[model samples]
Target: MTDSTYQFTRAITRRPAASVVNGLRAEDIGTPDLEQMLKDHAHYVATLKSTGADVIELPPLDGFPDALFVEDTALCLPKGAVLMRPGAPSRMGEVAQMAPTLRSTYSEVREITGPGHIEGGDILVTGREILVGRSARTDAEGVRELTAIVSDWGYRLREVFTPEGVLHFKTDCSLLDGETILSTERLDASGCFEGYRVIHTAPGEEACANTIRFNNLVLMPAGFPKTADILGKAGFEVVEINNGECAKLDGGMSCLSLRF
Candidate 1:
């Protein structure tokens, strides 16, 4: 395994048109104008690489169309890549497909399965603490099991739960930098992520909470002017990209791909 400060060597992304969203049944969201979607995805991939992050495009899956493939997951520490067991059943195939891609990039790759389903998006890794959100998507059994697996690496695991109806903790909160955190104002912070400086986004800027910290740069969804300004003031070079099409399917900048 490699010991280096979080350098994102590879990433995996899919075209939004191919994303599978379960709720929007009446409207044909999957069959949108793919030409433009492809164009946008290409631009996104290019921008991600421009940050010096290697980007790997996964071959599209045939059977599962509405897979919450990207956002509903997480990547393991060092070089032992543990593909998450996604909360949504439709996304199960994504982990299987992601395995080879990870093996091609890293030396060791593993899977978190059986009686313990979890998502990478719900797990936030700071200097030494690994904070996981136990919600509809991730369960206590999953967190305990994963913590045990990664304990040898010396990471402390903590669990937080959101009030009912909040899909994922990361959907409303994200660690922006070493000491800074971007979170939705509505989240209950009583015992969650204590001691870190909290930066609150505006009412509708909850989506902006999903920013990704790659190297020294922060990739944020374009259009949240206030959130961008806040991040900029905090000494992060913020790069904004339009994820309108992906956003329609409950996806965001961070949700579109995984960095490792």
Candidate 2:
């Protein structure tokens, strides 16, 4: 399994249920317009498939309001997948729901059984190293479990702390490739991205830090012109999508899919 985000061959995503407006959100950003959200999600899936990945589209789980953000439930690796136990108690059972899908594709599926809570969003798999963030959603035991599981997969592990205002580690950073990172000023100053070439999201476009690099195309949220300009100048082909609905629930480009 290479650490590069551009080396992925497949991805998994889920349809947002009608009850998505009931999903978790930090800032009371107003409710997501369900009708438009479905439209945007359809376009999102299309954009992902256009990147040449074999997209696994899962049906909506009406019982789980935030199930559309499937990346939080598990992680995809070259060797296998790890079913996560999300730190938010409300999101716990999502991991169990994702297991059948993982079993169908992976050979070495692992689980982070509590008193360990880890969400895929708090983990960054870059090249041969795995960076786990110590956040409200991922504790010390979670990081330890992640380390033990990834060690056998031949990955070097390191722990970084998520700043108070950030939701997840990846929320402020994304791998442009194995050697380059697109991040926000806050995270660049955190020392978690020392060895890589860190490109700060344009000053007012911090949300751009959550974009995803799939193969050569950068899948980013629309409405962030400055950051898009920077990425364009950096030589990445950008594919912007309207993420207003998803953003209402704290979701982003990477959160909607699990790529590997």
Candidate 3:
């Protein structure tokens, strides 16, 4: 049986460390408060567990400032998991740190051993196909390598473009379900999501577009009331978590965990 895009039996997450204040960002918004970030992280994991999924809580990696964004380390799928090669030089070590865990969990684990770089944040797996966007951290070569690897597993990978200035392809959109997508107006206008049911984020609430549909709940960043209401009315069970702290480091709900 194929994996449902939003259904999962387990997830992996890491605790935020004090070094998170030094995480890379597109611009300096503010230093993420460690105290608040921890609180939010706990809430995120709790919500996942509440969905009857096993939540693997990894210890903090103080050496990696962006370790809290575990989803970027690898892509978990039903067949196995693929380790990503992050474009950010500072984040390369993170992949090694995550490898052991994945190896122990998956009988087959592949790595993007390449001159090109990619991150899990740039890849979105829907029910029908895998959509990947080339960003500063994810290049054509990286996408090509990933395409080759997943193709052997009988998965179709499609190349797309990330909106200009977006940190990741998923920074502007997310899968609401197998056939539905939640996207920003700018991203939807790019036509990448053509042929899929699209729900545009309420104007000015584009930041909330990076949400995750985990099992029965749609976990989104708190404070985007309009977008939250839209999801609720659309027949989704929505749960809002405080994202102010992670937002400083360009992280969101989907960034915190790897589910499969």
Candidate 4:
């Protein structure tokens, strides 16, 4: 009763760890405000549930400062789920911690082992083909391993290099639908999403490109009003959630959880 056109009937999220103030990021943004973050996360969960997904909340991994950004740990494909080998050594343990839960939800659970480093943030599954970002966080070996894992499922893998200054390919692009991709100009110009209608985020609001399209609703980070207006003009309903804390850590809506 949960699965639908969204291809996601459930969402797995872990509470923000108190030690997140010490988490990793490209820049040294000030520490996050925990109280506000809690409120924001609550709203995020409520909004996701409004889309009809069963939200699975996992306990905070106090030992891992960046565990809240669980999306980097694994990826959930229609056929099954794949436990990743995070590029960040500090984040490597998160994949193992998430595997048990993934195994219970997916019919088949696979993993990227050894020298392979695969973060879900560097991966985009379009139901038909898989786009793997060749970024600092994702290597060719990891992409090759994932390709092998999904090759039997009729999913072809496309490799694209992440633009400089972008932490991940998804940091500047996201699929709005099968034929459309919401992205920043810099990313769209990379010719990454050829064949898909590319909708560029409003000027000065490039971060808005990292959105989560659930069913018919678009879960976008708040404070990007201009970008939200653009999406609205594109005929998509936008639900905004304040992610100040996550933003401080270079996280976004898609980074908070794994949906499948």
Candidate 5:
């Protein structure tokens, strides 16, 4: 199937000032106004449809408060959906809820079980390769196991390490197309998969790393003016929405939905 023919699911959530994780204490950060956050999420959903995407909503899962933004821990592809084992134990329940939603849209759905944990945010699928990150959130075991399972799909799996303070791979890098990638300046250029044309973003604009491509349009967070300009210069029709609240919870444009 072509990349443009896939479907996606996005869950809208109430703004949470802090995220709780096992071993790690909850982090408090200044957040966007609740009303604005809701508005932003709504706009994001609407934008997805406007761009000719098939959008669905996953029924909210209790206990897993972060399940609303479904994309953080799962990825949808032509063959099947990969239900990731989130590194944050607090977010593990998300995969269970995600599996059913994926099944509704695609016939095959699978899970990445582990001695290693993986997060959807750490995995990037290009036309020819799957880039998995070795981060505090994703482990080598998960990478090895998931790679083995996806080998049949003809995707070459490559690994990249998330810089110490960067929590997820997608937080530092996003595949824009088969050849272009949007990445943070902090990532070591030598470590990226060879042959990718890298577009480096300014330091604070790293949030730009979280972009979703549907057809020819790139969906991204609205607040980063410079990043949007950069994408525009690259000939992409960039669609930006304010995801300030989601960002406060360590989420970004791509985190709001699971696109098949």
Candidate 6:
């Protein structure tokens, strides 16, 4: 509805813990290097703060390997924040760990207490509505429950489908602006973004699809020169962060923080 979607005044991020080496992944690529992840994470936070926004850096959660991927824990909006119910049993506790911070940040907060599960990664909030894809981490019942909760706030929720084997809906797409989406060809072919301007990642650079547009800059994973060139040509200020370590854990720029 408002520019709060990308023009955020604040963001919440958690530092990666040593146990991040054991973070969940769709497949085992290689163990993530905590040292490298920390370095990249610092660069990320610093970049966010550079935009003159308040960035809250929460401490690491060693007990929870995927805690650094804070975006999966909640869906933050201008109206309020909704805590998600992750389908991953090991990741369910991450929601509770993120609750107190959100409760303190927003005047109103809601939770998805349900028989179904949904993770924030499966949701994409645009200027018009909320698009949620049913994935391994998100289900039909969870989408129905989320719709009911956000409906009270005058938000419309649309149910969509994640490509087979994708870890999350956002693994293949991201909003670059109110009406522009940066996506992979496979995901775009699904026709979900028909009404929006879609920018396909380079043929072999689909890994760069999971980026974030925060304020004046677009933070994307490094190593995708073609996509970066395309984004620059499109007038987006791009910042490339080395994602070698996080990539091993199936994480990207969007997973690092909760913007609002």
Q: After superposition, how far is residue 49 of candidate 6 from its true place, in Å?
A: 0.5
Q: In model 1, which runs have C-alpha deviations exceeding 4 angstroms?
A: 1-6, 17-33, 66-68, 71-74
Indicate whether candidate 2 or candidate 4 has the larger lDDT: 2
Candidate 6 residue 195 C-alpha distance from true site, Å: 0.8
Q: What range of 10 consecutive residues in model 2 has the weakest lDDT sum?
A: 1-10
lDDT of 5 by residue, 1-260 (tens): 23533233433222322232211223556644556766786787777777665667444344665765576667667677777888887878777766766677668777887878888888888766788888888999989888987887766788878877787888877767767888887774646756768888766887678787766678888778888888899988898887666676677777777776
- Poorest 10 consecutive residues of model 5 by lDDT? 16-25
lDDT, ranked from best to worst = 6, 3, 2, 4, 5, 1
* Cα RMSD to the true fold for all candidates: 3.2, 1.1, 0.9, 2.0, 3.4, 0.6
Off by over 4 Å in 5: 1-27, 188-190
Compared to the true structure, candidate 1 yields what TM-score?
A: 0.86
Clashes of each: 5, 1, 0, 0, 1, 0
Q: Can you write out model 3's per-residue Cα lDDT over 28-144, one digit (the tens) per residue?
A: 999999999999999999999999999989999999999999989998888779999999999999999999999989999999999889999999999899999999999999999
- Distance from true location, Cα of 86 in model 3, Å: 0.3
lDDT of 1 by residue, 104-186 (tens): 77687766876878887687776557778888878887887788777766667788886566666777777676656778887
Task: Kindly report which residue stretches of model 3 are placed more than 4 angstroms away from their true locations once superposed.
Answer: 1-3
Evaluated against the true structure, the overall lDDT of model 5 is 0.71
Q: Highest lDDT: give the candidate number.
A: 6
**Span of 10 residues, lowest total lDDT, candidate 1:** 19-28
User: How many backbone collisions does model 5 have?
Assistant: 1
Which regions of candidate 6 deviate over 4 angstroms? none
- The whole-model lDDT of each prediction reads 0.69, 0.88, 0.93, 0.85, 0.71, 0.95
Give one digit per residue, the lDDT tens place, for model 2 in 1-260.
Answer: 35454777888999999888899988998999999999998988898788788999999988899999999999787877989989998999888888998998887899988788889899887865788888888999988988898888887889999989899998998988778888899888979888888888998899878988888788999999998998899888999999998998889999999988
Write one digit per residue (lDDT tens) for candidate 4, span 102-187. 98898899899858788989887664478889888899999889999888676788989999878988889887777677889998
Q: What is the lDDT of candidate 6?
A: 0.95
